[model samples]
Target: MHEMMKAIATAALLLATAMPALAAPAPVYDERPAKLADATGVRDYERRAVEIPMRDGVKLHTVILIPKGAKGAAMLLTRTPYSADELTGHGSSAHMGIAIDGYDSAPDVVAAGGYIRVIQDVRGKYGSKGGYVMNRPFVGTSLNPTKVDHSTDTWDTIDWLVKNVPESNGRVGILGISYDGFTSLAALVNPHPALKVAVPMNPMVDGWRGDDWFHNGAFREYNLTYIWEQVATHDNASHYELPEADAYTHYMRYGSVGALASAHGLDQIGFWQKIKAHPAYDSFWQEQAMDRILAKAPLKVPTMLVHSLWDQEDIYGVPAVWKAMKPADKDGMLFLTMGPWFHGQEIERADSLGPVHWDSDTGKWWRRNVLAPFLAHYLYDKPMDVATVTAFQSGENRWQKLSGWPEKASSAKLYLHADQSLGFAPSDKEAALDYVSDPANPVSFMPRPNKQVGYEGNPWPTWLTSDQRPVSGRPDVLAFTGPVLDKPVAVGGDPVVHLTASTSGTDSDWVVKLIDVYPDEVPMDQAMGGYELPVTMDIFRGRYRESLSQPKALTPNVPLKYTFALPPVNHVFLPGHRIMVQVQSSWFPLYDRNPQTFVPSIFEAKPADYVKANQKVSVGGTEGSYIDLPLVSAPPAE
Candidate 1:
C-alpha cells in the first residue's frame, strides 16, 4: 500500500511536470474594442522608460505612453509592484504590450480619447529604487518628505508626472487591481492637487482580518508562494518553482511553514521573517491596516470601489474601506460596483466563473457603461450615468442598480436539524453530529486531481467558486443539507456561521462552507448533476475566537458557540436546488493544519503535537447552531 501510494504520488507529479506550467494572472490593461489612436495615428504615440525622482531621492522606474495629441489630455496612472516593462512595452498599446489572463483594457485611459498613460514600478520592485514594504503604513502628519512611505512615493511620483510631462492638463487619475489597488489607496492618503479620481479594485485594506495573508487569525498556507516568492524576495518578483511539480507533496514534505524557510535558508528575507514572527494579530499587522489608517481622514477625491462576488483575496477589505471612506451623498464620490466574477476576472473575461455563467460579458459591460463613463466624467468632464452601487445578482443572472450596496438586507437563520437536515425552526430535541479530524488526513480545499498544474495552480485564482462535490460526503466533514428549495432565496451581504461545537482536543480549526447544491438531474452533456458549488467560505483558528491578538486553548469536550463570518455573498439558491452548510476542521494545503494539542504557535509545533480531534457540532433547542444569512426579497415583478 505504501509503495502504491508513492507510485501514485510520483505519477501525479510526472503528469503535472509533463504539461506546461500555468502562469499566474497578468497585470490588467484596458481591453476595450476601439483604439483611441488609429493604426495610422498609433505611429504618433511615444513610449519612454524613465526613472522619476521621489521626495526621498529614490528614483522609481516609470513607463510613459503619450499619444501624439495627448499634450493637453488627462494623465491616467497605475502604480504597481509588478514590472512596468510588463505592463507597457516600447510604444505598444497597453492591451498589446502585456499578455494578461483576462482582457482588461485601461478603460479610464481609452475613454479619455487621447491621454498620457503612466505605469511605474513601486519602490524596491522591478527596476525601481528603495526597499519595497508590503502595505507600507501611511506616514502621518510628517512634514519631512524624506521620511517617506507608499503614500508619499505616490504623491512625489504624481507631482513629477504632471509638472514634467509635456502639454499637461494637470488632471490625474489612478486605478489598479490587487497590489496596484493597494498603491492606489496609498495615493489617496496624501493626494496631490492633480490627483482628481481614484478607483481601487479589490485592494488589500487589512492583512489580518481578511486578505491574502490571514483570514480571522488563521494563516493562509496556500498563499505562502505569494509572500515568500513574490513580495518578500529581491527587486524581481520571484515564484516558488516546485522540483516535485506537486505543491501539495512539496508542502507536505516541508511539514510546517517555518520549515519551508529554515530548511531553504531564507531567514534573511524581511517579509518572511515578519510573517513568521507575527503568528497572531499583533502591532506589526495593525500598523499595516490601511483601512484603519484611512478612517482617520476621509477621502476628499472622487473614488470608486470595484469588487467581484468571488474575489478570493481582498473581498473583505473593499466594503470595509468603502464604509470608512464614507461619502455623505449616496450617488456622490464614493461608489461600489460588484459583479459575479472572480478576483481580477471582472477586468478579464467575465463570461463565466468556473461552470457558472452570469449570462453576459460582464467585463465588457462594466468597462463600456460603468467604469469608462465614471472616469470620463471625472477626467474629461463628460456626461455620465452611474449607479451609487451596482451588484450582479447571480442565480437570476441580472444586474441591480441600488441606492447603496447590499440594499438593507434582512437577516434569516437556517438551523441545523437532527437528521443532517437544515431548516428555519430549531429542533426541540438536542442532537450532535460528530466527525474525527486527523491532521494526518486533512480535507482538500478543492476536489481530487488537485495537483498544481492540472486542477489549479498556486494563487488559485478561481477556486473561490470551484465545485465542492468531492468533500461533501467525506467522513471528516459534517454536512448539514437543506431540502430542495421550492422558491429562490437571495442572499446578500455577509453570512454568519453560528456553530455550537466541541472538540476532544485542546485546540481546533473550524471551516464553514456555504454551498448551493444543484439538482440531481441535468442534461446528459452538462455533466453537472448534483454539483456542490461553494458560494462563500471562511476558516477560524479556534484559539483566537475570543481575541485575535490573544489565543486561548479550549477545555476538552466543552461545547461552546463558535460564531464567525463566511465573508459576504450575493447569490440566489434557485428552486429545485438545495442549500448546504459543511462544517469541517481542516482544509489542507490551502491552510496549515491545527496540532489539536495546544501549542504557543502551530508554526513552532513538533510533529508529536499532531493528533486526532473528534469534533461534535450540537443542534438542538437551546444550543442550536445556525447560519444567519442576509436574505432579501426578490426584485419586484417586472
Candidate 2:
C-alpha cells in the first residue's frame, strides 16, 4: 500500500510540472481608459497638430485652433516651453471657451475675437526636436553656437502660419504670460513681416538681475525646483517631491542650497551646473539679459509690455525691459500696462488679491478694454484707441490712462529718523539702530507651514500681498514707522533706497521693504485693519555692492553706502494710513542666506561660514539713510 501511494504522488507532481506552472494567471489588464472619449458632435473648433520644420532642420510640435466657419481670421500665436497640447486641449467641450483655458490662452479674448489660435512647443521641449537651453542665447552669441534660437524659431513659425493656414489673415499677433511671455518678447527681435504686434505679460527679461534666478546678487533658492523639474526631461515628466510640509524646514535641513541640490541629484542638470559655475553677474548673464539685448536690437513691431504690481516671479523684468526699450521707441511702437494683480493674474480673475478687493473685475476690464482692443487694432486693422501707458492705481482702485509712464512725478525723500520714526525731514543728530543677524535662525519670508513655490495649491502667487505683521515684530527686523497721513500721498514710478549701513561680518545681505499700513479700524473689511502691505521691496548682496561682476569683501564694522532701487510702485497712501519701512538681513528660502564671512562662492560655503553678525543702520545726520519717493499729484475723478 505504501509503494502504490508513492507512485501516485510522483505521477501528480510530474503532471503539475508539465502543466506550464498554472499558465502564470494571464497578465492583468490596465482597465483604466487608455484615451479620452472622442469629441465628435461636442467639438466647436477645428484642431490640427503638425510639426513645423526649423532652419536647423528640427521640427516643433504646434497645435492650431481655427474657429468654426472662420474666414480671413487673424492668427494669434503663443510660443511656449510648456506643452502645446496641454495648453490648447485642457478640456473637451463644444465651446472653445471651455476647451482652451490655461496659463497662455485667454478664453474671452480668443473666442470673442474669432482668432486662429496657435501654440507651439519650443525646441527640445515637449514635442520639439533639439537640445534645450534655458533662455536660449541669441544665435550669434557664444552660449548658443547653433543657428537656432527663440527668435529664429518664432520667425519660422510665423512664416509657416501665414502661408499654410487657410482660415487666417496674413497678420499675426503674439501674446503670452510668464515663460511664454519671454518667447513673445523674443519674437520682437527681428520680427517676421507678418508679426505685427507682440504682448509680453509678466515676462522674464532677466534671470540674474532681480528676476527668476536671483534678486540683485542674492540667489532665489526656491527656484531650484523649477530648474529641477523643467530641465530634467524634455517633456517635464519629472516632478519635485517635497521632503517636508514646511518648505523653510526642508530648505534649512541642508546647510546651503547647493548641498540640497546635490542631494537631489540636481548637479547633473546643465543649468544647475551653469548656475554654480557663474556665481557673479558675468558675461553669461549679461549677454542673455533680454532688456540689454533688445536695447540694441531693432524694435520694429508694435509691442505692449504688461506688468503686474505684485508679480512675485518677474517683478523686475517688465520694468527693466520697459526702461531699456523706452529710448528705442522712436515710432511710438511701445506701450505699457500696469495692473494691480499677482503674476499672470491678468490672464485669470483679478478682482481681488489677498486682503485687498476691487469692487469690479479688474482682469475682465483690462482684457476687454486694454488687451483686446490693442490686439484688434494691430492684427485686424480695427479702429481702436489705446493709451501709451495704462496703469492701475492701487488704493484708489482705478485705472489711469497716461501719455507716458513715470508721469513727470516730483521727488520726495522719506528719511529714517531717530527713535524708530520715519519723516519727510531728517533728524538733527546721527542715530544708529542695531540688530543681530543669525544665519542659522534666519527670518522667514512668509508665515510658517509654508508651501513650496507653485501657482496651484500654494500661496506663492499671493504671498507678496500677504500681511507683513509676522516679520515686522521680529527682533532682527528694524521697523521705521511714519505718522498717519492726514492727506493722500500719491506715488508713481520707482522708489530708490540710499542706505548707510555697517555689518560686523565681511559679507551680508540687505533687505529693504516699503510698506503701507492700513488704519487701525476699517468699516468695509475688519480683517484688513492694521494690515501691513509691502508696496515695493528688494534685496542686495553686499559683496556685489560696488560691482555686479566683481565680488569684493566688505570692510567689516565700517559704515558703507548701499544704494539700490525698489520695484516701481503706483500706490496712494490714503488719509489715516502710515508709510513704514522694514530692514532685515535675510529673507530666507525666498533668497538664500548670505554667509556673514566672505566666501569665494556662497554656493560652496561650508557650515562654519554661517555666523551671527551685528548689523547697524544710520538714521540721520551726515550718513543718513532715506527712500526717494516719486511723488505725483492725484489723478482727476473719473
Candidate 3:
C-alpha cells in the first residue's frame, strides 16, 4: 500500500482539475423490472422451513434456499432478527424470502448466480426457541439463563448445516441488515469453519452507544414504539409493546424526552434502563459489543462492508469497525462503501423503482458485482469481478473504487480557536467556554414540528444533519462560526473533538454539533426545491470520550481529551456557506444526563450533585485541537 497515498493524491489533483464540470445532471437509474419474475425456472427454486439446534439447545427457526438438485455447492447464510420473509421484500424478487438450512433462504438468487443460501432467526427470536433479550445481549447473572448467544448459536447452526445439507460446499457467508446486520457480525465473532465471507450491513457495532438506541449520545428514546424488548429476551425473541405511539410528539424537545423518561421511571429506555444498572463498563455491555474481541479475520475470501454515511442510525459504528479489521494485509481483507442515505432506505428505494437519486446504491452494486461473483468463485471457481474498494459519491451519483478509504487525500485538521473562530488560533485570550446543563433544559439542535408529532423518528433525514440554528439562540449552546469559504469544500469522514478545560464539579458532559450553514436561511419548506425542511446537522456526546469501554467521571477543573466519531458524510459545502461547530454541556434525555457529580451512574445522582463547568477549545502548539476530514477527491463530475 506504499503507493496508496501517491495514487490518491494524483487522483485528487486530477479531480480538482475537473471540478469545473463536476456537477452532472443528476444521473437517474430507472427501477429496472425484476429479472427473476420472467426468468426460466427461477421461481421453481427449492425452499424449506427448518429448525436448526444449537449446542446450547436452541432450535432456531430458519429457511434454506437451494437451486433444485444443487450438490456440494457453497452456502451463503443470512441471519436476521427481522423475519426471513421480510428480506424478500427488500431485495430483487428472485432473492425474496428466508431460510435456515443454509440452502433455501436465497436459492433463487444464488442459483441464478449459482450458489445455495440460508436465512435463520437469531437465538431466541421469531420461531427460534429460547428466551430473547432486547438488543444483542451479554450474558446476564448466573441464575438460569440462555444456553448460547448470537455468536455461539451461529457457529453451531453453520457446523450442522455444512454437514447435513447435501450440496454443502462446506463454506458459508453470513449476511443481513439492521438487526440481522448485528447478527451477521455476531456470527463472525466466534466464527465457524464453514463461515467464509460475511456481509454485515448497517451493523449495530457499539451496543448501547450510537448504533440503534442513542442518536449522537442523545437517544431517539421512542419508548412506546421501540421493538427491542420483543426481539431480545432470556427464552424467545418476540414482539414487545412500545410505550405507545401516542407518547411521542415531533415538537417535544430534549426536555420532553427527559420528562417522558421520568414518567416511565429512571432510565425508561429498556436497554438503557438495564444499562444504567451497569453504569461502569461492566461485563454487560462488553459482551454485547463484538468489536472489542474481534475475530482473526484476514477474511480468507472476498467480503464487502456497506453502510450509509447519512444512516440516521448505525453511522459511526460501521466505519470504525471497517478500520479495525486487523492486519489489512492479511485476513483483514475487507472493502467499504458508504453513501448518503439513511439506513436501508436506498436498498430498493422506498418506491421500489428508480432512476434512483438517493446517493449511489451499494446494495444492488454489491449484489451484482460482489455477491454474485463471490458465490461463483467460492462455490464454482469463477473469477472475481471488481476492485477492492467500491464506494458511492452522493453529489456525483456515481460509484468509484479506491485502494482504501478516503481514497488518497491529505489529512488536515480545522481547529476550534477559543476566540469564536473555527480555524487555527482563537482570537481570544480566554481559556474556555462554559454552559450549564440543567437536565431540565437540554439545548436541542433538532427541529420542532407540531407539539404532538415526533420530529425525529421513522421517516428520518427530516431531523438528520439538519441545522444548528434551531438551538443557536439558547444560552446554553456555545456556537462557533467560521468565515465563508471561497470554493466548494467537501468534507468526508469521522469528526473528533479535543479540549483542555475541566468541570467545576466532579464531572460534566460535553455536546458538540457540526452544521452546514447555508448562504441564505433556506426555509425548511423550500429545502428540496420548495420542499420545507431544515439544513443538515449532527451531534456527539462527550462523557465517553477517552474510552467507550467505560465512562469516566471528570475531575473538578481538570482538562480532558474527548475524541468521539461523528457520522460520515459526502455533502458539498458550497462556496459562501458558513461552516460551524457548537459546543455545549448537554443533549439531554437523548443521552442520559451526566450528574455533574461524576458518580458511578448519572441516573442515580440527586439534584444537589449537579454543578456547572467551564469548557475550553484551544489552538496553537501541542494543544493541537481540530476536526479531521477524510478529504478524498472524487472523479470529475460525470
Which candidate number has the best TM-score? 2
lDDT of 3: 0.57
How many clashes in each structure? 7, 0, 68
Query: TM-scores for all candidates?
Result: 0.88, 0.94, 0.73
TM-score of candidate 3 versus the correct structure, residues matched by position: 0.73
Q: Report the C-alpha lDDT of model 1 over 242-276, residue by residue, as the tens digit.
A: 56665567667777767765765557677778778
Q: Model 1 — which ten-residue stretch has the worst lDDT? A: 96-105
- Candidate 3 lDDT by residue in tens digits, 25-83: 76778788756354525654566678887786659888776766677777778776656
- Write down the lDDT of every candidate, Cα atoms only: 0.79, 0.91, 0.57
Model 2 poorest 10 in a row by lDDT: 448-457
Off by over 4 Å in 1: 1-44, 90-112, 140-146, 231-233, 237-239, 327-331, 453-459, 523-525, 636-638
Predicted structure 1: lDDT? 0.79
Sorted on TM-score, highest at the top, how do the candidates line up?
2, 1, 3
**Best-performing candidate as measured by lDDT:** 2
